[model samples]
Target: MLKPSTLNNKLRVLLIEDDTIEVMKLKRAIAKLEMPHEIVEAKNGEEALDILRNRDSLPDLILLDLNMPRINGLEFLKILKNDEVMRFLPVVILTTSSNRKDMLECYKEGVAGYILKPLKYDDYVEKISTTLNYWSSNELIKG
Candidate 1:
């Protein structure tokens, strides 16, 4: 467990994923990194839109899963990019799909980055840790 005194800045990350197990894995990975980040979750794109619209402050970044129950990641990306307030927000796709079509589409829709999930836990942790580190070091626009 991380002591509050030792913790640094908490970067808010909106995680839009439908699978409960995948969400848990991601949480574990972030925790292992000890990155001092906060995660807000949504099961699907519609839910994510609602959360974004209702909240006063926006997150530093969004971690999106392409294969979701409703409105999927691509649709979510489109909606987010179209919105005036959320258009500038960074969105990174974390997904199992490695399809070239999907990758091109996400880039077309304005995703900041696209990450393919590794099958192994250790690899996943490593990937997540690196991503967190990079984002933490970079400056994000104030919401």
Candidate 2:
């Protein structure tokens, strides 16, 4: 498990999701962790791209959902991974998609990790906590 002390700086997370309930669940899971991480949200990949383009800085990590109204996760991943500036930013797939193709594609495109959102609340919390712990302990490309 990763200790908060292991990470001297607060994590900056960008959540790209379209479902309101799922977003709430993710926020709840994050709150349960009690880590001092900052989260920014985008409803879809298009909005996420716009946010990335307009912002002067990028988030340390990006939590992406596979399904959305515009510019689905795979497409977004392609765009992000191809960019010289954004390619270094770590991206994690946090979606319910269990597609083998999706999994393979994300890995090929350079996702830090691929996590399927659990059906139960406790399971969800555990998954989120473990993921954060691992990422928090490991050194990122940004470092």
lDDT tens digits, residue span 1-143, model 2: 22355444567889999999988988887777777777899999989998899557698889999998879999999999999899988899999999999999999999989999888888888887777666666677233
| Regions of candidate 1 where Cα sits further than 4 Å from its true position | 1-9, 141-143
Q: Give the TM-score of candidate 1.
A: 0.90
> Relative to the true structure, how large is the alpha-carbon lDDT of every model?
0.85, 0.85
User: CA shift at 86, candidate 2, in angstroms?
Assistant: 0.1
Write candidate 1's Cα lDDT for 1-143 as tens digits: 22222323467899999999999999988777766788999999999998899657688889999998769899889989998889988999999999999999999998989999999998888888777666765667331
RMSD of 2: 2.0
Candidate 2, pairs of clashing residues: none
What is the clash count for each candidate, in the order shown? Answer: 0, 0
lDDT of 2 at 41: 97
Clashing pairs in 1: none
Q: Model 1, 8: alpha-carbon shift in Å? A: 7.4
